[model samples]
Target: MPERDTIMRELHDLGLAAWFGGSMMGAVGLNPAAEEQGTEVDKARVASSGWAKWTPVNAAAIAAHLVGAAGLAVANRRRIAGQKGVLASTLAKTALTGAALGATAYARTLGKKIELASSPEQEKAKKAEKHPISVESAQGQLRIVKWAIPALTGGIEVLNSLQGEQQRPSRQIWGSLRRLASA
Candidate 1:
């Protein structure tokens, strides 16, 4: 493989790692931690604070994924024209990444709502059983983003293998890429 190709692969791998890790952290660590820290009334505030703290880190991870995706696109642009599987994989990754981004934004908005409810005036609003939106929505959005990372990353990996195959002279693209990566 060319040095540029290898470098691009490494960057893509790094981005995948970040995307997966950040999603996992938000879903498993931060969300759970916030839940454990507060009562129903205060839960949103707590969760929001935790997520707010996590925002910059998550942003960095998403940025890494974007950079890696750009690298992959640049490296594989020529080969993608002839590879149906590669094209499909790319499309899948793009869709999943977009979903993850949307979910992240939704989670952030929910977090902000939680923070808003933390105020003294909002205390009265909180006491109403159905007034504050269900925590389930926030949790669900986070879950969507969390699962999306792995699904999308996995798709990218498959796509990467297909791209690698297209570069080879004669070996079957999918099988060869998998074998080479495994070895």
Candidate 2:
């Protein structure tokens, strides 16, 4: 096939950058700031508000990343099918992305629970959906899941680098031969 030019690479890299940076900033900056600025009773509310504001942007970033990934996959179908290790790495990246998405969704759910539990507005608190677990327990889980998001996304970045390296002329030639022999 002829060489195909696309902006998928830029989209993928920039989307991942936003996702990673936003998560890290929320964990390190926004959350701490909320805790410090708000009263004891309002800390969770403050943090939850900030995260709520970020949710839409984060969703967009994740969507862009997924679209770019699909585009790249379609463009490189032959390479993925014929290159040794490429298929494995692609599969691993897919799984990691799914995990990251799940972590993000779970953390958001936990955050919402904390927000309701901490709010002074009894009506709002009452309106919040009940979780099977206590708000305190969800908070504890959120603390860990929040950090896991950035870590998993960072791992995806590393895997992306490996994929780029594998595209090198020498690596591609060797990978193709290895793939052929194994087949």
Candidate 3:
């Protein structure tokens, strides 16, 4: 049995790496830099600008990851269906990906609110409704949501590791036998 080509695996890994690294850098570096610029409003503006610049690249990375994930899933469907724990772990990873996407969206929404609230234009401020909470409160929530993106993506990384281990020939055979024994 020869090792298969790793192009899709590399794509998946690189995309996840970017997602995790970018989120972490934003939370750690960008946010703090924005905090240092000046007043709370300026902080929001600075942070929003940085995030706006990152949005396209981040989106691309996510798209690549989704495509790679689908390719891998389709390639390994038989193993996933037959292996003992692969199905559960794959489902967990899928759920986590959904949660990460949701968190990222929520963070962007909070960021837009902050951007508007901090804007100089009265019309823009009026257009960007904070809803149910004040701008300051929204900022607090945004902090949590921003951090959560990295956290959830990091969990996906761990799950990816587990999936890799499950693919080892010995483990695959053991898992299949275990499934048969249970049945």
Candidate 4:
């Protein structure tokens, strides 16, 4: 048996958990609540504020997840290379991660656009000042980008489950055997 990458596993699981949960909550709860704000401008402001607050923690979680995933990949390089289905799943996970990252970055970018576009005249950020977008345009972009993160991260969790099952000793043995038989 191999030594467990315990820390890496925890970081990977926890970070992903936070990432998924946060996106779900924002989509299901925060965004909906923000939509209830009296005016359209208020709605966008509330939503952008909620997203802004989450941005730092989300970034940290994403970073932690990536670091943990890299450590785990290195630790499990042999299994990933030799075990049947593992490589395929890992590749799939990687693709999902990439998509999630892109979606996250895009959403944050939209958030910044919203913040800039919606900020009170007196409280504008310099960067946002330089690139002016209409509040309606920012809101429109946000609406479209909203679902991608949760969906991508949710797929990652599903793949995580599959990968978890693949780690069973019997399954490992069978997978490796299948690989060997096919070689």
lDDT of 3 at 20: 87
**Candidate 4 segments whose C-alpha is farther than 4 A from its true place:** 1-4, 123-129, 132-134
Q: What is the lDDT of residue 26 in candidate 3?
A: 97
* lDDT per residue (tens digit) for residues 1-183 in model 2: 233325777677788899999999999999888879646567788898899899999998998888889888998889999999999999999999999999989898888888887778887677565667677788789779989999999999999999999899899999999988988
Q: How accurate is candidate 4 locally (lDDT)?
A: 0.86
Quote each prediction's TM-score. Answer: 0.66, 0.92, 0.92, 0.91
Instruction: Put down candidate 3 lDDT per residue, 18-41, tens digits, no spaces.
Output: 988999999999999999986888
Ranking by lDDT: 3, 2, 4, 1
Model 2, position 20: C-alpha lDDT score: 93
* RMSD of candidate 1 to true structure, Å: 6.5
User: What is the clash count of model 2?
Assistant: 0
RMSD of candidate 2 to the truth, in angstroms, is: 2.0
Q: Give the Å shift of residue 44 in candidate 3.
A: 0.9
For model 4, residues 55-102, the per-residue Cα lDDT tens digits are: 899989988899889988998898999899999999999999999999
